[model samples]
Target: MDLELFLQQLANAISLGSLYALLAIGYTMVYGILRLINFAHGDIFMFGTYMAFYMMTSFLLPWGAAFFIAIILTIAFGVLVEKAAYKPLRNSPRMSIMISAIGASFLIENLAIVVFGGRPKSLPVPDLFNRIIHIGNVSVVSITFITPIITMVALAVLMFIVNKTKTGMAMRAVSKDYEAARLMGIDVNFIITFTFAIGSALAAIGGIMWGLKYPSLLPLMGVMPGLKCFIAAVIGGIGDIRGAVIGGFILGLIEIMLIAVFPELTGYRDAFAFVLLIVILLVKPTGIMGKNIAEKV
Candidate 1:
């Protein structure tokens, strides 16, 4: 490929990777704290985008206000899901919690279809996102640049919260042993709910970005992206934040480059993630940054 084309593809890859990383971080954070996969997370993503869409179209709010409100609502929804679906099953077997998560996912998707209607709706793109930028022979949307910067800033803030604060210490302790942390005076339930709130916020931001990039919305839109981000989390080492970012970038690059190099394989783009997942699981089931842990008896 020519240099310009390659650069264009690279920009697309980075943008897509940023979205994946944002979503994957949510997955990693929840798993890190609760040892539970929030399968409903992608639906939360869909909910956020729909909320923003309605805020803009139905409520006639500006993009900034719409996005802010949508994120807040999404966070609340996520916490509710935690309390209603996962919290009660926490002391139960892991399998039971997993099933609950799946059921929650289905419930949200069906509800979305009923509420948002099954028809695909177009997101009204803001001028800022739609504006085109030129660099030599390559041109790309402004969102391409904005996405990575947003991802980096969000990651930095999250790292600070996770590494440099008392809350972080409590979170780490809880992750190590919930009962032990509770014994040590940490509010374990609060920590889990806080983690969900953060995860939901990220999902909301990612969903907004996804809508700007793709513009078309469907009830099932989050399904593929959600699964792909989950794979990204697993590939990066599910509980490690840095690993999730690395895995997301790697997945994005491979998918974009594969399609660019061989246009015929465009149809198989989704398959690439699954193939990578299988390879990672076989080669390093614990993931690149994941340390093997003894199963709790």
Candidate 2:
């Protein structure tokens, strides 16, 4: 590919990667603490998009305020999901929790269809995000450039919260050993809830970005991206935060570059993530950053 084409695709990859990174972080965080894959997470992402859409259209709010409200509401919804769907099953078999997660995902999607309607809604683009910037032979939107910076800042904040805060310590302890953490007087339930809140908040950020980039929202919109982000989490090391970011970038770059170089493969673009997932699983089940642990059983 020519330098200009490469640059343009690079910009696209970076923006797309930012969204995946945000979503993947949520997946990894929840898995780290609960050892359960929250299948409903993608639905939370879908809700974020719809929340932002209604806030802008129905509430007549500005993009900034609407986006903020969407994130807050999305966080609350996530926490509520955990409390209602997963909490009661905490002491049950692991399969029960997983099944509940799947059931909750479907429930959210169906509810979204009923409430948000079956038709797709157009996402309102703020004037600022629509501006284009030119660099040499490459031109891209302002949001394209801004997204990576936002992702980096968010990552820094997440790292600080995970590494430096007292809650972070509790989270680490719980992830390491829930029973042990409880024995040490850590509020395991509160930590788990907090993790869900943070993860759902990240999903909201990603959903907002996804709506902006795609400009179309539907109840099923989160399904594909949600699965892709899960694949990214697995590829990067399922429970490792930093690894998820790396995996997101890898997935984004590969997808963009494949479509750019071979237009024919555009039809199969989504399959590439699954193909990558399979390869990663076959070659290194633990992922790049995940360490294999020996079970006592």
Task: For each candidate in the order shown, give its overall lDDT on alpha carbons.
Answer: 0.95, 0.92
lDDT of 2: 0.92
lDDT of 2 by residue, 106-130 (tens): 9999998898899889999897887
Model 2 off-target regions past 4 Å?
295-297
Residues 1-297, model 1: lDDT tens digits: 999999999999999999999999999999999888889999999999999999999999999999999999999999999999999999999999999999999999999999899999988999999999999979999999999999999999999999999998898999899989999999999999999999999999999999999999999899999999999999999999999998898889999999999999999999999999999999999888888977686
Candidate with the greatest lDDT versus the true structure: 1
Model 1 alpha-carbon drift over 4 Å, by segment? none
Residue 23, candidate 2: how far off, in angstroms? 0.1
Q: Please give the range of 10 consecutive residues that has the lowest summed lDDT in model 2.
A: 288-297
Looking at candidate 2, what is the lDDT of residue 272?
A: 98
Best by TM-score: 1
Estimated TM-score for each candidate: 0.99, 0.98
